[model samples]
Target: MAGPPQQAEGSGSAQASGSSTARKTFELNNDVQVADPSDSLFAYSRDEERVLEDAAPWKKDPHYFHTVKISAVALIKMVTHARSGGAYEIMGVMYGKVRDGVFWIMDAAALPVQGTETRVNAGNEAFEYMVNFQTANNEVGKDEMLRGWYHSHPGYGCWLSGIDVNTQMTNQSFNDPYLAVVIDPNRTVSAGKVEIGAFRTFPEGYEAPQTSQYQSIPMDKIEDFGVHANSYYPLKVEIYKTRLDEQLLDLLWNKYWVATLSQSLISSNRAYATSQLADLGAKLHSAPLDASAKLKKKDEGVEDDATPLNQATQDSVRINTELQNGMTAQVIKEKLFNGKLDAEGARKAVLGVL
Candidate 1:
């Protein structure tokens, strides 16, 4: 299958994009700062001529945008909120400015909105809260503009849902140069990496080129993933940080190390694991155990991604890998926290797990 549409290549605005390789997760890296002090046109916190308020280039061309570079603090905050949501959904808005088709996500703050009990109504009050939030931000001098929104899917996977496509469409209608980001916290834990995707809906009546980028989604949600996969496309996401951001992360690594050693992510997310197994069983009932089975009949001129022999094979591989990863986490918890193994032994086992 063809992959998602790639960024236009070679120089000019395309040169502003990062590596073509997809980012599995955010990691602090030692790279040169984006802004150079000697050059005088850049600030550590701001980019030169970053905001293009006059022209809506993206409106003229849907493919104009290609990448999203989130700051260290922004990504940290997003994943933290996403994980906190656990099995339920949590939503937030991002703070950034657009330049050269990239969303420079500087910071993220959680909204009171969620798809669970205790979710604050996103009424006029939600707008009121955002205004107050921005007021507080301005007071502290972190006055970045809103560029996009982020939400968690919990376990389903990082793809836009029907509701998500409509929401993003409305946002794009009013908020050009906007983005919708999804984070799958449950998969992130199992994969030992951030499960994330950034997307923008196609304009109405616009026939987007057919492309597909596979995500290791839950078996139960595979249909939903397939049906809505074409409504929008994923952006090539990258992360950036200032030199001070790198220094702070290094200083905090010790704290994170201690926490990682003690926390059992699997134990905490047992509900998700149970649901995963249930989904696997449901998928197995509908899938052929024999991947080599030949189809008896097929619809003419209609391409079906699922229900084919190859799809069954791929699904089995994903299912087996999912269960294996879950078992590894369980073992890690047992050996590390349940007194089944010594600390050194457990630590060594965790190296491959993480």
Candidate 2:
């Protein structure tokens, strides 16, 4: 995992052959924009570079030649994770030569882990981790932030599926530019045979997708380089736990108890009010309840004298209760027919069952 492959780039040029594509260039000067700047999921820093973790020969699908930059460490991590029968995740750093309209992946790195079933959904946790990594190392605001994400498609080939598009859309919708990478675990083999494809959620009005064949990365030649040996092995304990905790916290904050509890409370209150209103209406219509009201009033001789606050509170409760019992008015000529309901519409909508 610590060595480099002899070949680089999409061309068949080997490092030993002295081809320009084989030479590693670390110069930083470009726009490096993400696929969607409005996305909230990930930000891109076209300038940041992560450590390459492998020495294996890497190949890219021809279609993605201008779209991604596979760094030495990023490629090694991918091979190591693929070799272990586990899912791998990539923090893809992007580079865009604004004049050429093409995107390059300048850096790709991952936190390796072992698990029975690997989930590689690129969510906020991954974003925060990469962002923090950049910040702690004083690399924040260098060039790009969080560009995109890469994950293995397991035994699946290097093509984006409908589900894959949907998942990537989830990533892209985060108001940041992001792309999804699919590596064919089964297709990755000795030397230069690894197949990889990159994708981004295209904007509206784009042409429909083509599903005829697998998208394949081109192989120019085989070469060797350097990698971090530890990246090729199982991830260390601290890194694994740290990533796991971040993911767990993100899930809890975004998904669990608080949101559910608030929604539940609103629903329960609406239901209770509806039930109370129905019971009150039924009691008014019943002969027995009618008799009790008269008798109780006469016996107590109180004339139901309640204070203004108490009476007002009762009226408010009854109105809300009636609303819960399905009381509503129609809109006429684009105007609300009921002024009371219209004035309180916002409050009522929030209070009512949704």
Residue range 217-322, candidate 1, lDDT tens digits:
6665666777878778788988777767655665555234445545455566577667766765666665664333423333334445555444545655765676
Candidate 2 lDDT over residue span 42-96, tens digit each: 2322232221101111112122213444443455566566555633333233322
Q: lDDT (0-100) at residue 211 of candidate 2? A: 32
Q: Report lDDT (Cα) of residue 141, candidate 2.
A: 36
Mark the 10 consecutive residues where model 2 has the least summed lDDT: 221-230
lDDT, residue 58, model 1: 86
- Cα error, residue 124 of model 1, in Å, equals 2.3
Clashes of 1: 0
Off by over 4 Å in 1: 1-51, 117-121, 288-354
User: Which has the greatest lDDT?
Assistant: 1
